[model samples]
Target: MDRKTKIALGGGCHWCTEAVFQSLKGVNKVEQGYVASHGINSNFSEAVIVHFQPEKISLKTLIEVHLLTHKSTSNHSMRIKYRSAIYTFSEVQQKEALSLLDEFKSKSDSNIITQVYPFSAFEPSRNEIQNYYRQNPEKPFCKQFINPKLQLLLQHFSNYVNEDNIKHTDQK
Candidate 1:
């Protein structure tokens, strides 16, 4: 069996991030959750823990998709809780994320404010919140916010998308 690896990401809302990663082919699972907490304070930024097949999808690709899908350059004033972040589980993951950040920064003039931090803990979101886009596609928020992001994923990362998600998206 292929070895799987995991990474935690915080990009705006967990619902949107979870939906995007779930569509990818090599992603074994995506759990919406809160990460890097501190007891009752629970720095608990909305995040997703992605379990994936390294042979099928490189961590670099996942990070790239993440940066592209979210507004990494925007100030967090509109939604302080939704700051962009990449929480690494190991030194290797942190290095890869930082390398990607440099690469992305070199490519674009916009400041990439996506924070990189060591992974502390993850508290899964309520069941109702998991698989949100799949469960509530018709909701105005999903249609207005998520659908476009999904379309962008399909357009730019067509090879990474799951065939089932493509068919489901097509039927809509």
Candidate 2:
């Protein structure tokens, strides 16, 4: 069996981010919660720790999907609550994330503000809200905010997306 790896991501609503990662092929689990790094990012922010098999999904692909799914370029007012960050478990992971961000920055007109920080801690959300999207697919927030991100996954990362996890708009 392949060893599972983890990467913590935060940029938008935890519900939306959780749903997006949950729909991916290699993702074994997504721990929806608040995460905190060191120094300036000491305060917990909305995020999810994605557990996956690297052999099935590359870190670069995961980062790419994450960037595309959220407002990676925006330093919005709620940024304190929803930090744009990639929390890595190792120095290698941090370097790769930084390299990927730099590469993306060169191609896009807007700066990729997503920072790579060392993973420090994670506080899981309440059990009631753990799997928010899957549990409440018909919720207005799921339909309005999350569905679009799922659709984007289907459109651009179809090979990496788990189609079974996608609740089609017609079915909703």
Candidate 3:
């Protein structure tokens, strides 16, 4: 078996990001958390720390999935709290993330605005917010915002999804 690795990602609400990544086949764990931001005031962005097997899925693939599942380009009108970002724990991760961004930039029309920063700290979200979608599937926000992302993953990345993580009845 391959050793697992962890990466912290912030694309949007932690609840949404957590639910999407938790379904991936190689992902052993997805913890919702807050990562220190580059902005003033020492605020934190909602993020997820994902533990996955690199042998089963490459970091590049994970980065692709992340960009696809959330809006990486910033919208000036939207709050900066949920801006897309990759918080790297090492120089290798930072390099890899930049390479992916370059690759993505070359293939797309719009710019990839996802930020890459050295990880400072990760504060796990409260219990009520963990495993949110599974526990509150019927919540309006989950049905409205999260279900579509889940369906997109199911359709485009079926091979990466864990069987047990396929909880959407409509997809089944």
Candidate 4:
């Protein structure tokens, strides 16, 4: 098994995507960063570098998790920079991604606008953003934005949470 471990992603903003994926069961860590954003440079867009155990989570499952996260909060249009996306690192990921779009198109009644960027570059986000929601849970961004998204995460991805650090999203 190839067991690819990381996927670069940017969904509107990192805080929301990070908050959600950071709680997934197989995911080891979700690092905030940027991917191509300049057209072919979609990798330049803000992203979350997800580290996971491929043994536990298939690439398809990761993509599904991403799409689910996107669907949950997409009503507010926070999925672009805050929008949901999965940046592909391989041809398999690419094909699987295209398959996902096709699957979503057939299953849903709404038009979806998301970026599927090929690998390019990833500049780790600033230290302040490393865990913006956790460190400043009382801040406006956390209270207004991150928290609302967290509500979505809790409602949907609760199984991924570790009771000991359920609020790690606010602390890290």
Candidate 5:
């Protein structure tokens, strides 16, 4: 678990997910990209690839972070382009992911549609796309959508994120 485990996750739009993961304590990096494996079947889907430290965090925690985001803080871009997913790098991770999803559904108020499968090649998104929300926090999309999600993070999951990255704007 010393090495970072790569988890390919798509939670609607990559911009905000990148912003969100960048604020995490154990997430080494959140890569914006097109999952070539997913794109092979469709003409319109985009994705986010997350590389995180499993020693500092767990895949279950990663999934929880994504589920919380997609459930309560998403908009049309994610709805149309992104679907909740975990692209696994190993068979053990695959089993754990499904088990967690099943357990989560049983305890939750609503059903989840998170897709889990094996990993494949990905095309990295360009430099400009990385941390787009932070770069343009005042943009209409960031102000209205990503801001609210950040607010939710500040209000509720304050302990889970990298508090050093939390800004003055996060003050409530």
Candidate 6:
């Protein structure tokens, strides 16, 4: 069996992030939840633990997709609640994520504010609210907030997308 790795990501609403990761090909599970890093980031923030097989999808690709799907550059008022961060489980992942972010920054006109932090703790979202998008795809929140992210995924990273997990009608 292939070894699976997990990474926590936070940028936008957890619902949106969860759905976006769920639509990916190599992602085995997306745990929508709250995550806290060390130091100043001790407070829990909306995030998702994406469990995936690196052999099937590279971390570089996952990080790239994450950067594009959310407001990685924007330092908005709700940043406290929605931190722009990548919570890495290991030293290697941390270094790789930082390098990827730096490389991404070099190519962009705007500064990338996505922080790379060591994973500290995670509290899974309440059962009723977990997998919000898949259960409530027709709801306004899913349609308005999540559908676009999935569309962007299909547009730019279709090769890594699991088409079966996505409802094409939601893209309309």
Which candidate leads in TM-score? 6
Worst 10 residues of 4 by lDDT: 163-172
Number of the top candidate by lDDT? 6
lDDT of each: 0.82, 0.92, 0.82, 0.65, 0.70, 0.92
Report the C-alpha lDDT of model 2 over 1-172, residue by residue, as the tens digit.
Answer: 7989999999999999999999999999999999999998999999999999999998989999999999999988999999999999999889888998888889899888999999999999999998989889888988889998998888899898888888654432
Model 2: residues with Cα > 4 Å off, grouped in runs = none
10 residues in a row with least lDDT, candidate 6: 163-172
Report the C-alpha displacement of residue 46, candidate 3, in angstroms: 0.8
Which residue pairs show backbone clashes in model 1? Answer: none
Clashes in model 6: which pairs?
A: none
For model 4, the superposed segments whose C-alpha errors exceed 4 Å read 1-4, 37-43, 70-84, 168-172
**Cα lDDT of model 5 by residue, 72-136, tens digit:** 23344454467566677788888988898787777778667777767776777788777787678
lDDT head-to-head 2 vs 5, winner = 2
Query: What's the residue-level lDDT of 69 in candidate 1?
Result: 91
Encode model 6's per-residue lDDT on 37-134: one tens digit a residue: 99999999999999999999989999999999999999999999999999999999999999998999999998889999999999999999998887
Which wins on TM-score, candidate 1 or candidate 6? Answer: 6
RMSD of each: 2.5, 1.4, 1.8, 4.0, 3.0, 1.1
lDDT of 3 at 23: 83
Clash statistics: count for each candidate: 0, 0, 0, 27, 1, 0
Q: All candidates' TM-scores?
A: 0.90, 0.96, 0.91, 0.77, 0.83, 0.97
lDDT of 5: 0.70
Candidate 3, residues 1-172, lDDT tens digits: the string is 7898888898788888998998888899998988874546146878899998999988988888898888876665553577588888889989988888789878988887887787888899889878998898888898888888888887888888775775763555
The alpha-carbon root-mean-square deviation between model 3 and the true structure, to one decimal in Å, is 1.8
Q: Which has the higher TM-score value, candidate number 1 or candidate number 5?
A: 1
Worst 10 residues of 5 by lDDT: 36-45
Candidate 1 lDDT over 1-172, as tens digits, reads 7999999888778888998899999999998978873343247788899999999998889988999898988876844477588888988889988888788878988998887788888889988788898888788887777877788888899899885763445333
Model 3, runs deviating above 4 Å:
37-42
User: Which of 2 and 4 is ahead in lDDT?
Assistant: 2
